[model samples]
Target: AQTVTQSQPEMSVQEAETVTLSCTYDTSESNYYLFWYKQPPSRQMILVIRQEAYKQQNATENRFSVNFQKAAKSFSLKISDSQLGDTAMYFCAFIDFGNEKLTFGTGTRLTIIP
Candidate 1:
């Protein structure tokens, strides 16, 4: 069984600053993929970043980056220079190679304070 945890239920960051959202997961599988998805009021899950279990390098996309600590089963998202548009409900998800379903964590509502 695989489970994802987001300890923080809510987070607030000042505009133009940086914020890191924590996420931890438990899994017995040796191979998998971790993802950070942001869903705003519209409820569309947007892929923020993803890391493959075999990849040594942390995945980064522009201002969104993930710190993938494989051994610890920790995957956290760091948003640099946070913007108002970044405010959303962030979810951590996991998926194995053959599975089409995503196991998601309790979302963390992030607010960008101006």
Candidate 2:
């Protein structure tokens, strides 16, 4: 069974600052997919970034980026120049080859202090 872990229960960052959320996972499969999803107060799940296990390079989207360590099974998210809108509950998830279901971590509640 593959499992994702977000060690931080909550994090706070001043507006316009940068924040990094930690995430780690345990998976036996050599090839798979990793994802970071954001759920705001509205509770809508939004894809932040994604990384394919085969790719050694991390993924980036605007202010969002990932540090993917396949050998260590660790994937973390970094938010640069954060804004108040960035406040949300961030979840790290994984998808197996055959299973479409996403296994998510407990989540890290990120609060951007304005």
Candidate 3:
């Protein structure tokens, strides 16, 4: 079984600043996908970034970027120029081919202070 860990239960950042959320996982599968998802107050899980275990390049999307450390089995999310809209619960998840469910971390609630 694969497991993800987010040690920080909550984080706070001022607007326009940057904050990085930590994530780590343990998996024996060689081929798999790691992902960061943001769930706002609306309860919708939105994809932030995805990193394939085989890929060396980190994934980035606008203000959201992931520092994917394949060797260390770590995937962290960095949010730049944080905004009020960025306030949400962030989750780290993993999934391998043929798997029907995504194993997820407990979550880290991020609060953006204006």
Candidate 4:
């Protein structure tokens, strides 16, 4: 079983700035998928980005990116040019290969200060 941990429970950043939310995980499985999910005030969980444990390159999506350290089991999300629309609860998740079950962190609530 895998477990995700988001050390920061709350974070605030100025609009148009950059912010990074940290996340770490523990898993016995070697191959898996790591994900950063965003839940806006609207309460819809959206896929921000994903990283494959077997891949060396970090995964990125538009303004969102991840710094994945496989050996360290860290998968932190970096948001460049933060915006008000980015205000939300961010969750880190992990899925073992072929298991399809996702283990999620408690989440970090991010506020974009104008």
Candidate 5:
């Protein structure tokens, strides 16, 4: 069984600031994929970044980056230079190799304060 946890239910940060959304997961699988997804007011889920458990390198995309601690099963997302458009519900997700289903965290609602 696999489960993802997001400790912070809601958070707010000023525009242009940096914010980190915390996530922790547990899985028995030796190989898996960790991901951060963002859902805006439109309710469209967007992939922020992804990390392979076999890879030691953290994943990054533009202003979005992840701190992936494989051993600790911790995957946190850092959003730098936050923008109003960045306000959304962030989810932590996991999926083992060859698994078609994904387990998702409860999510953290992030707001960019003007």
Candidate 6:
């Protein structure tokens, strides 16, 4: 079974600053996908970034990036130049090729302080 663990329950960052939320997972499967989804107060899931397990390089999207350590089963999200709009609950998810369902972490609530 693959399980994601978000150690930080809550994190706060000042606007225009940077913050990194830690996430770790345990998976025996070699082929899988990792994702970071953000849910604002509206409760809509937004894809922040994604990293394929077979890919060696990390993935980046605008101000969002990921530190994907496949060997350590750790995937963390880094938000650079954080903005007030980035305030939301960030969840780490993993999808195994065998199963289409996504396994998500408890989530880390991020608050961008102006």
Clashes of each: 0, 0, 0, 0, 0, 0
Candidate order by decreasing lDDT: 6, 5, 1, 3, 2, 4
**Model 2: per-residue Cα lDDT over 1-114, one tens digit each:** 888999999999999999999999998888789999999999999999999999999999999999998888889999999999999999999997878889999999999999
List the global CA lDDT of all models: 0.95, 0.94, 0.94, 0.93, 0.95, 0.96
Candidate 4 lDDT score relative to the true structure: 0.93
- Candidate 4: the clashing residue pairs are none
Superposed Cα deviation of residue 6, candidate 4 (Å): 0.3
Worst 10 residues of 5 by lDDT: 64-73
Worst 10 residues of 6 by lDDT: 68-77
Please report the candidate that would top TM-score against the real structure: 6
**Tens-digit per-residue lDDT, 69-103, candidate 5:** 98898999999999999999999999999798989
Highest lDDT model number? 6
TM-score of each: 0.97, 0.97, 0.97, 0.97, 0.98, 0.98
Give the local distance difference test score of model 2.
0.94
Clash-forming residue pairs, model 1: none
lDDT of 1 by residue, 1-114 (tens): 889999999999899999999999998888899999999999999998889999999999999999999999999999999999999999999998778879999989999999
lDDT of residue 50 for candidate 1: 87
Of the candidates numbered 3 and 6, which has the greater lDDT value? 6
How well is each residue in 1-114 modelled by candidate 4, as lDDT tens digits? 678999999999999999999999998889999999999888889999989888998888899999999889999999999999999999999999879788999999999999
